[model samples]
Target: MLVHLLYASRAAHTMSGQDLVAILKQSREHNAGAGLTGLLCHSDGVFMQLLEGGRDAVNARYQRIASDPRHKDVILLSYAEIAEREFAGWTMGQVNLHRLNPGLVLKYSATSHLDPYSMSGRAMLSLFRELVSSGAIECS
Candidate 1:
């Protein structure tokens, strides 16, 4: 069955531009081979990601992510079987919150910032969908 998992985590430290690029490259390659598609948003040392694919693949990937030393306080926000993929066009779409619209951020959360911890998993997913529709996010 197809499933989608949403999770959030804090970076162990501020990531450099090169580190982010490497991460995106590796994620796109790894997810493509694993038959996963999703969106990832990062800002201010926090990461919110959604992974959609076969239940086993998604869960396995999430487990790896949870154990990765680069992330701390990993929290599984949502996980369930889904009728269809929400981010099927990309292996791993990326959104750097610095380039995102402040208004949209405020629309979802109480503040004009990316704080998935403050919003429900559904709210975070909706925000990502809106950003994609608005061309605010760049997909690999």
Candidate 2:
């Protein structure tokens, strides 16, 4: 069966642009071979990612991520069986929230800034969907 897992974590340190690029490169290459698809968002030192694939693949991937040294305070936000993939356009798409509109962020949270720890998984998923629709997602 197909499953999707959403998770959020804090970066161990400030991630530079080159670091982000390297991450995207590694994720895309690894995910494609694992038959996974997903989207990633990082802002204010937080990383939120959604992974979709077979149950085992998704679970194992999450395990690896949760144990990785680059991530700290890792938390699983959501997990569920899905008949379809919401983010299938890229092996691992990136959400460019650098230019995100404040209003869009306010619509889902108490403020204009994103704090995944303070938000519900449902709300974050909704925001992710909106990002997809608003052309805020990018792939490389």
Candidate 3:
């Protein structure tokens, strides 16, 4: 089965721009090596990621993310089985939320931000798509 996991983590205050870049690099390498696909969106000190891959592969990646020191308050948002990969065009694509205009957030999230565990994968991705299409979120 193709597992899709949505998770949020509170980024540590010490994370620098370089550290974010490094994390994205690592995500790309790992996702490509494991044949996983995903989209990661970050905003307001929150790291929300959607990972799609084989059960074992996805779980393995989640374990690695859980141990990363750059973040805390890790929480699983949702998990589901998918028949096809939604992010086939992405390796380990990243979208920085800070680039978004505030209006975009209001349009997609109903609020200025999202609460961890309050949204399902479907709802989260819908919001993600809006932001992506609006040029509010940019790939890294």
Q: Which candidate is the best by TM-score?
A: 2
User: Pairing residues by index, what is the TM-score of model 2?
Assistant: 0.97
Question: In candidate 3, how many Å is residue 77 off?
Answer: 0.8
Off by over 4 Å in 2: none
Per-residue lDDT of candidate 1, residues 1-140 (tens digit): 99999999999989998988889899999999999999887888898999999999998999999999999999988888999998899899998565688898898899986798898888888898898888877875
Clashing pairs in 2: none
Q: Model 3: per-residue lDDT, tens digit, 1-140?
A: 79888888989776677877887888888789998888877666778888889999999988888997877888887788889987776777777555766565565555766654555556777766665566553444
Cα lDDT of all candidates, in order?
Answer: 0.89, 0.92, 0.75
lDDT of 2 by residue, 1-140 (tens): 89999999999999998999999999999999999999999888899999999999999999999999999999888999999888888899999877577799889999988988988888889888999999999998
TM-scores for all candidates? 0.95, 0.97, 0.81
On a 0 to 100 scale, what is the lDDT of residue 67 in model 3? 92
Task: Predict model 3's lDDT versus the native.
Answer: 0.75
- Supply candidate 2's per-residue lDDT for 85: 89
Error of 2 at 3 (Å): 0.9
Clashing pairs in 1: none
